[model samples]
Target: MTQTWLITGASSGLGTALALAALRAGHKVLATARNPTKAAQENPQIEELGGIWISLDVTSPDTAKHVTDAITTAGGTIDVVVNNAGYSLLGSIEDMSENEIETQFSTNVYGPVRILKGILPFMRAQRSGTVVNISSSAGVDGAPSCAMYAGSKFAVEGMSESLSKELQPFGIRVILVEPGYFRTKFFAAFVAPAAGLTEDYVGTPVEAALKAIKAKDGSQEGDPVKAAQRILEVVTSRGLGAGTEGFLRVPLGQDCYNRFQTKIDTLQANLTKMKEIAHSTGFDS
Candidate 1:
């Protein structure tokens, strides 16, 4: 069955790829970007694949209203919403400014949340929907120089996990796609260091991380289109939409897979070691 999708950040990378994939899957999509014209120009493939463009800056106070209006004007309730618009404002906690951090949160965290707020009433009226939050491995595992980004992702992950349960009775599902790295203009002229900070930590972990990112930029192992396809597959899986068929956290990319598996393994081992104590505290009988 074809459904309508409202995908934010559909201008590039995973968002753009997901937009194309969804369209190819026979779904109509309302793709949003900061500048819809530039987005369409930058990624002509999306237009070629048949996607309608809309203006959406995640940092805007009008996000909820904007999305609400777009959905209303399009004459369709959003069947799915992919909160894929976010960027890494990489900086040390001490190095980042209040304005920078707030700006990051506004887009990376609050924007999506507001979008959810706007769409919830519609989804509730329909009594069914899916929300895919484009999170990051940083949500679960942290690498150096990702303090702020991780915080934002972690915020998204926490909400998705809980909302998956909260909306379960309503037949709505929330999924988090934690992807590691891919070639995207997230760092292009579109973003910048949040001012008031000097990049003097050059030879340190942050610097090393930046070097590593550029080193592997275009050569990232995971294909964005394939990743987007996988998301659609998951979304359409019969029993998974209610969050009963499987896990809430779907880590994409070899980089993410390994890190997530390691974290889970370590957590399991720790739980096993504490099993006896945990059980002991559970029952006095």
Candidate 2:
């Protein structure tokens, strides 16, 4: 079946990879970037591969409406929407400035929410669609020096979980993709440092973790191409492992899978430990 896939941040990295993969899989791709002209100049393969490149800044208030209008004007409905645009702020939470924190949330959290709000009406009308929110392993488990980034991703995950339920009746599927460290520019030139540095926390775990992350930037093991292919496989119901339909969250990479299991185990243990107390608090009816 031919599908129309709308992907954000398609200028590079996983976004580009996914766009190309979708194209190769016989799906129409609407690839968006902050600057379409610049993105095209940088990566002409997207256009060459039949992807329609559009200008889109996720942080812009007009972006969602513009995208919705464009699709409507073109007489098209998006079958799959991929929210893949985001960046990380590597530093202590205390070291982050107000603007930096808000920026992270604005791009990583609010941006996707706005996009979904704009697109849901169309999906509801059609009564079938899929939304894939690109999160991170940090969303499942916070890491040192990544409090703000992880918080933003966690927000996405929580929202996606509720949305999956809300849209289920309408036949719209919501998927949260939690990817571990991948061979992408996310950890290279794209990752930003804390704008406001706190001297008091110079020798803390946050500082050490930031240094380690910088050192390990380009050496990540996960391949973006493979990840993109796997996403397409799941979205298309080809059944690569568990189908995307029954799962709300898809943890990519072995590292992410391991961490996800660990988190599940920890949650189960905590629940057992607090079960009696929690049940007692329900009240003495």
Candidate 3:
């Protein structure tokens, strides 16, 4: 069965790859980007595969309404919604400015909130749909120099988890895709750094982490095409979106899988250590 997919941030990277994959599979794709004209021009293959480009800036306040209206006007229920528009803000928490942090949250967190606000009503009304929130391995574990980016992704992870439960009754599935590092133009898209560097933190882990990311910018091991294919397989599956009826996350790449395991192990260790104390604090009756 062909599904109608609405993909945000479709100009490049995983978004573009997913859009093309859906189109090639005979599914109708609505590819949205901040600059639809530029996206269409750059990725002509999308149009060649009968994909439609729509302008959608995730940070815009009116994005929700625009998205809902666009899909309504297009005359079909959006079977799959992929929230893939976001950027990385690399810096120590102390070094980041208020505006810088808020800007990252606006694009990474609030934007998806608004998009879901716009599209979820239809999904609920129809009682069937799938939402894929593109998160990062940082969403599972925050690393040095990634405080702001990880915070935003963590918010996405939490929201998607809650949303999965909220939409389950309506037969809508919310899946969070956590990818470690893909060979995408993610770095090229944008990397917000701290405006002013404090002397106290120089030559620390923050600096080293930032340097490592810069060095590994284009050498990431994960392939976006394969990632897209994997996501497509899940979205088109017979059962709950991605065969994750009882789950919420899909960690992509070996790095992501390792990080996920590390987090789980850490949590188990903590629980083992504090289980008695935690239970005692909960109730004295």
Candidate 4:
């Protein structure tokens, strides 16, 4: 089955990788970024690969309509929509400026939501489509010094999960991807600040987290190409069966897998204790 894909942030990192992978899979891709010229940074060869690049600033409310138009103009109804364009605004809740926090939600949360809002009409009309939203490990298990970033991703996860159930009857599948740290400019580039704190605050726990992030920005072992390949495999190359949930949440990388296990362990440990209060604390119960 040949599927057309509309991918956000296709200029670099996972977006670029996935865009290429989709192309390699013989799928049509409508790739978009804040700046198409900036997207040509690492992969100038992408231009020759039949990947259509379009200008898109997710922060803008009207950007999703532009994205939809690009996708429609390139071909037709988008079979798969990958919401992979997001950045981390690493900072503690208090350490973030007002505008910085707003920017974070604007890009990471609201942008994706509005984009989906624009595309859902098309997908619903098609009666069969998939939406793969790229959330982060920080979104699931939380991490030190990444509270704001994590919150944005958490919002994505929650929305995707609920939408999956809602769209099930409509034959529109929603897949949530939780990726661990990978070698991307995301952590290296400070798109948003950690707030302007005093020099004394530099060595504080929040600052330490920032320092740790700086050190690990490009050190993660996850391969973006491999992750992209896996995504395509799940969505296209392979299938479990008719009416089977192949992967509701695909956790890529060893870090993601391990963190998922750890979260499961914590949940299991608390399960018995949770039963004790389940009935007592709830008025409905």
The root-mean-square deviation over C-alpha atoms between each candidate and the true structure, in angstroms, is 3.5, 1.7, 1.9, 2.5
Q: Which clashing pairs does model 2 show?
A: none
The residue-level lDDT of candidate 4 at 29 comes to: 83
Q: Which segments of model 4 are wrong by more than 4 Å? A: 192-194, 198-204, 237-244, 282-285
Q: For residues 46-160, could you state the per-residue lDDT of candidate 4 as single tens digits? A: 7787877788888998976886787678766889999998888876676688899899899889988878887888888889899999998987897766788889999998988
**Clash pairs of candidate 3?**
none
For model 1, the stretches where C-alpha displacement exceeds 4 angstroms are: 187-202, 238-245, 268-285
Please provide TM-scores, in order, for all candidate models, with all chains considered together. 0.87, 0.94, 0.94, 0.91
Query: Whole-model Cα lDDT per candidate?
Result: 0.82, 0.87, 0.88, 0.82
Clashes of each: 0, 0, 0, 0
- Model 2 worst lDDT run, 10 consecutive residues: 188-197
Candidate 2, residues 1-285, lDDT tens digits: the string is: 889888999999999999999998888898989889999998888888888988788898887798898678656688999999999887877667788888898999999987887788889999999999999999999988888999999999899999999999999998888899899988876455546458876788887887888888889999999999888887877858354579887889998999989999999999999998888876568
> Residue 56 of model 4: what lDDT?
85
